[model samples]
Target: MRKWLVRRALAVNVRVKILGIALGVAVFLGGATIVFLRGYLVRVWTEDLRVRAVEIARDNASRSTDFLLTNNLYELYALLRGAVDGNPDVRYAFVLGPDGAVLADTFGPAFPADLLSVSTVRVADDAEIALLQSGHSRLHDVAIPIYDGRVGTLRLAVSEDRMRAQIGEVVAHITLMTGLAAGFGIAAAFLLTYALTQPIAGLLHATEAVGREEFAHRVDVQTTDEFGALGESFNTMIERLGVVERQRTELLKRILTVQEEERSRIAHELHDHTGQELTALLYRVSVVAEAPTLEAARGELIELEKAAARALKEVRLLAFEMRPAALRDLGLAAALQHEARAFTQLYGFAVRCHVAGLGEVALDGESETAVYRIVREALMNTAHHAQANNASVLVQARNHTLVAIVEDDGVGYDADAVLAGPPETRFGLLGMTERARLIGASITFESSPGAGTTVYVEIPIGAGAAEGADDADSSPDSG
Candidate 1:
C-alpha cells in the first residue's frame, strides 16, 4: 500500500503535488482551529451564562427580602415579574416559601409544580446554580436564599439559547475567514509551484534537444541559486559535447585518409620493388630452361636462384614492415629495439634504445600493440617534421607503471599551435593520443619552436610483476 501510494504520487505532475500539499495543510489547520475555538467559546460562554444567572438571582433575592418580610405578596409578585422582563436570557423568575411552597412566580396561573421542587438553597451565604432541560432549550437554574432563608428562596432560570446563537455566529465567521485564507494560500502555492517548475521545464526541454543532437540549445539562467548553477553547468556540458563531436568527426576522417595512404604505399612498394624482382626471376627461369649446354644451364640456374632469393626477401621485408613477426615473438622491448635501428637507418639519425625492468612488467597484447604504435607514430612525426639529427627511445618499468619516452635533438614546433592547427597536421598527434587512451595510458608532448620534442607515454601495470622492478630511467646505451 505504501509503495502504491508513492508510485501514484510520483506519477502526477509537480504542480498537482504542490497543490495537494497546500490544500491538505490548509484543511488541517482550518479544521483544527475551528474545533478548538468552538470548544473554547462554548466553555467560556456557558460559564458566563451561569455567572449572569446567579447574579440576577442573588440581586432579585436581595431586593425581594423587604417585600417578603413585610408580607407584601403583590410587591413580591411584581419583583419576580420585573426580573423576568428585564433580561431577555432569563426564562423565568420565581420565589419558593421556606416550607417549599410557591409564593410568587412569573409563570402566572400556570406555575409548574415540578419547578417548585427543582431548586433549593441549601447554603444561604451564596447563590447555588443547577442545569435544567426545558423541552428544546437548556437552562441554568440559579437558586438564592431570601433573608437567610427565613423569607423564601428565589429561583431564576437563564436559557442557553442566546449564548448558543452567539457561538454559532462567531464559528460561522471563523469558518468563512478560514476558507478565504485557504483560497489565498492556494493562489500563493500556485505561484510558488510555477516559479520552481519553470526551471525544471527548461531543463527538460534542453535535455530533449540534446537527445536530438542539437548541442547549440542553451538554458536561460536568471537567478543566482542552484537552478541557475544547474543551467550554467548544462550549457557548459553541451558546449563541451559539441567540441567532442567535432573532434570525433575529424578523427574518423583522419582514419579514412590514413587507411588510403597506407594502401597506396603498400601498392606502390609491391609494384615498384617486388614486381620488378619477380619479373627478373621469371626471365632467369626461362633463360635456364632454354640453355644449350649443361654448363650454360647451370650458370643460368644459379642466376635464377639468386633472383628468386632477392624477390622472396623483398616480399618478406614488405610483410615485416606491415606487421613485424618480432613484435609478436620477442615482446615489446625487442620489437622497439628493431624499430629504433630501422628508424636510425631510414631517417639518417643516430637512434638509441633503452629498457629497464621491462621484462618484469607483464603487458597484454593490446597494450603492447598500442604502446608500440604510439612510439612508432611519434618517431615518424619526428622524422617528417622535426629536423632532428639524433633520437632516443626509452622503455622503463617504475612504481607499478610502464613508461615510454621518445626524444629528439631537433627543431621542434609549438606543441599547442600544432595540436590546435589544421586536422591534417594534428592527425598524427591525435592518433597517438587515441592509441594511448585505448591502453588506459596517458601521453604528453613537450616541445617548443627551438627546443627538442619529447613524447611521454605512461601505462599502468598490474601488481603481479611490479615488485622488484627498477624505478629509475634506463641509461641511453642499455637495451
Candidate 2:
C-alpha cells in the first residue's frame, strides 16, 4: 500500500502543475518587487516631501509681510525654521519683494527676482509659490503670499534640502524590505508547493501502473491530509481490481467451456439427427424415381431430386455455421480462408485475404471457435450491408495481438448510428462486439455514407496457443 501511494504521488500531472505554479510564483514576486522598488515606494517619499514643503511656506507667509511691510525678521525666521529643532527640511525661509529683494529670510541667500515673479504668485495674487533649483543645490521649494487690502507684494520661501534627505532614507528602507520579502516568499512558495503535490503524484502513478496490468504496484504516502485519503482510496481500487480480475478470469473459463460444450452437442445433432434424416429421405426419393410405375411422372421425379439436393446443401450449411470441422482440421488460418472464399463466391463480391505473421501453430478449441465466429460475423455483415463489390481480409500477429480486419468498398452506413440503434437494427454488429468482449479483446468499425466500411478485431495470443489472423479486406458490391 505504501509503495502504491508513492507511485501515484509521482504522476506526471502533478509534476507539470508543480512546475507551472513554481514559475507563476516566481513571476508574481519578481513583478511585485519591481513595482515596490521602482514606482510605489519612491512615489510615497516624493509626496511626503511636497507636503512638508507646503506647511513651512504657509507658516512663514503670514508673519513676515502682512498689511504693510512689517519686517519682523526674528518672528519670520523662527516660523520658517520651526525654532531650529533638529528638522533640517525647514532650512531657509524668507520673503521677496516684487523686484526680488529679500525681505526676511531664515537663511542668507537673495531670492532670485525672475524666480519670484514667475513662480506660483503674480503681482497682486496671493498664492503658493513653487520652484526647483537647477545648478549648485537641489531644492523643490514652495512659497506663499501675505497681504492685506492695502498691501500688494509679500512673499515667503522655504528651502527643501531636508525633504530630499528624508525621501532618500525612506527609499533605501523600502528597497531593502521588498527585496528581503520577495526572496523569502519565493523560496518558501516553491518548497511548500512541491511538498503539497507529492501524495497526489504518487496516487496517479499507481493508477497508471495498474492500467498497464502491473497489479502488484502499490502507493505509500503517509499523512492525514486529503492526499492521504486519496492514497487509501487508490489502495482500495487496486484491491478491487485484483478481485475483479480473478473473478473475470474464472468467469471467462466457465463461459468458454460452456459455449464449447454447447457447440459440440449441436454439431453432433446436425451430423447424426438432421444429416441422417435428410440422407434417408434422399435415398427413398431416388429409389422411387427408378421404379417403372412412375414413367409418366418423370418431371416430378426431377423436381424431387432438386428438392433433395437443396435440403442436403442446407444441412451442410448448418453444420458449417455450428462449428466448422476445418477449424480443428487445417487450423485457424486455413478455416478462415475457406470461409472467406466461400462467402465471396456465393455473394458475388470479390474477397481478398491477407495473412502474415501467423506462424505455424496450434490452438485450443475455445480460442479457435471464438476467433472463427468473430470473423464469420464480420464477413456476414460485409456481404449483406456493405453493398460492396470489392472486399479484403487481413490476418496478422503483432504486438502479441491477433488482428483481423475486414473491409468493403460499399456505400458504407453511419457506424455510430447503426451501432447506437435498437437490437432489431444493431443485432449483428452487437453480436460481433459481444464476441470480442467475451475475450480480452476489442473491436472497432469505421464507415461513412460514401466511404467504404472496415471492421477490426484484435485479441492477445499467448506463446503456446494457435492464433488466427487476417487483414483489411474489401468486398465491394457497389450496386
Candidate 3:
C-alpha cells in the first residue's frame, strides 16, 4: 500500500512539473503581448484627445477675436471669465496685448503675464501656434493671429491638467479592461489544459495502480479519441500483467521452498560425508607432503595443498556472497565501510566512505540488504561500465532523512535511456528502486553525456530501519 502511494506521488510530481513549465511560458508571453498592445493603443488614444483640444482652442480664439474687433470689451471679458469654470483643460481663454500686460485672465494674478505674449509679438506662418515651454500646470497658452483685416492677436489658453485628467480616465478604463482580459485568458488556458490532459492523468493513475500490484484497477475510458484507444489497449495490457504477476508470485514461492530444502540436504551431506573425507585427505596430504624424503612426490603434494586451499577459499567466498560476514556481524555503516575498502583494493577503483552520526544508528534487515546491495551493485557497475579514474561516496543527514550519494567522474551514459531499457537490462536499477520503495525511501539517478553519474538515496530513519537491524546483526560465523 505504501509502495502504491509513492508511485502515485511520483506521477503527480511529474505532471505538476511539466504543467508548471507550461504555466510559466503562458504568463510571460501573455503579459508581454498585453503590454505591447496597450502601449500602442494608449498612443492612439492620447493623439485623438490632443486633436480635439486643439479644435476647441481654435473655436474659442475665433470668438475672442470677433469680440475685440466689434469693440465689445464687456462681452469679451465675460466670455473669458466664464471659460474658467468650463473645464480644467481649457485653462484661460483671455487676451494679451502688444504690451507686457495680461488684458484679461479667468485665473487670478498668480498666472504668468508673458505666458502667450511671444506669439502675439512676433507673427509666424502656422495653423496651431505653440508656446516655448511644456509646463507641469493646467495652463497651455496659445494665440490666434487675426486675419479679419487687422494686426490683432487673440491670445488664449486652456487647462492642460484637465485635458490629461480626461485622457487618464479613458486610460484607466482601458487598464481595467486589459486586466479583465488577462484574467480571462489565464483562466481559459488553465481550463483548456485541464480538459486536454485529463485522459493522460487518468492513464498515469492507472499505470501507478498496476505497478503497485493492484490488479483490479483498469483503464476503461470509452471514446474514439487517441487517448481512449490507448486506454482500451492499456486495459488489455493490465489484464495480461496481472496473470504474469500471479505466476511470478507462485514461482518465487516454489523456488524459495526448493532452495531451503536443498540447503538443508547439502548441510547434512557436508557434515556427514564431505567433511570427514576432506579431513582425512588433509591429514594424509599433510603427513607425507611435509616429509623431506621422496622429492619427486613433494611437488605434487604441494599442488594438492594449494588446490585444497583454493577450494576452501572458493567455498568461503560463495557462502559470504550469499550474505556478508561484516553485515551479519557489525551494523550497516561498518559493513558499508568494509565493502568500500575491499572494492578499492580488489578492483583498483578509489572509493571513499565517510560516516557521521552513526554511533548507535542501525538499519533494519530489509533496509540493510537493500542499501548494501545497492552500493555493491553500484561499485560493480562502475568497475564494469564506468570508465572512471576516480570516484567518491558520501553518506550524511540531509534535511529530515539520511542521504547516500555515490558519484564518479566517468564517461556517464544517459540515465533516462539506461532506466528505460529492458527490465532484464535494468535489473540493477529495478532491484535498488523496488527495495528503496518498499521501505519508504527514494532513489535518484543523475548523469550527463560526458560529465559523470551520481546516484542518491534518501532513507527516512526511524522504526523501519531499526526493525531489520537486529536480524542483520547476526554474526556470519554464528550462522
Candidate 2 C-alpha lDDT tens digits along 1-479:
99898787676465465656666776676667656665664467666766665655554455445423565556655565563344565445555555556655554565545655555623223445455664655555565555542333333333445545665676667656756665666567667776777776777789799989777788886887877887888888898887657555655565577589878977787678667767766766766767667663565567666767766676777777667777767667777778777887789887777666665553456656777887787778878887888887787777677788888899899999986664456656666766778787789999999899898888888764334443333333332
Candidate 3 runs further than 4 Å off: 1-42, 45-54, 65-72, 82-88, 114-128, 131-139, 147-151, 160-163, 196-202, 205-211, 219-224, 249-479
* Candidate 1 error regions (>4 Å): 70-74, 98-103, 106-126, 133-137, 172-188, 279-283, 468-479
- Number of the top lDDT candidate: 1
- RMSD to native for every prediction? 3.6, 18.5, 20.1
Candidate 2 similarity to native, TM-score: 0.40
Worst 10 residues of 1 by lDDT: 470-479
Q: Model 1 over residues 240-262: C-alpha lDDT tens digits?
A: 99876777789989899878998
Instruction: Give lDDT: candidate 3, residue 281.
Output: 60
Alpha-carbon runs more than 4 Å astray in model 2:
1-55, 65-87, 103-117, 121-125, 133-140, 146-192, 204-214, 224-226, 236-479
Give the local distance difference test score of model 2: 0.66
Name the lDDT of candidate 3.
0.66
lDDT for each candidate structure: 0.86, 0.66, 0.66
Give the clashing pairs for model 3.
89-159, 90-158, 90-159, 91-158, 91-159, 138-160, 364-465, 364-468, 364-469, 365-468
lDDT of 3 by residue, 259-348 (tens): 797798667666665575577567758777666778746765776677577557656655666688777777667777777777777777
Error of 1 at 320 (Å): 3.3
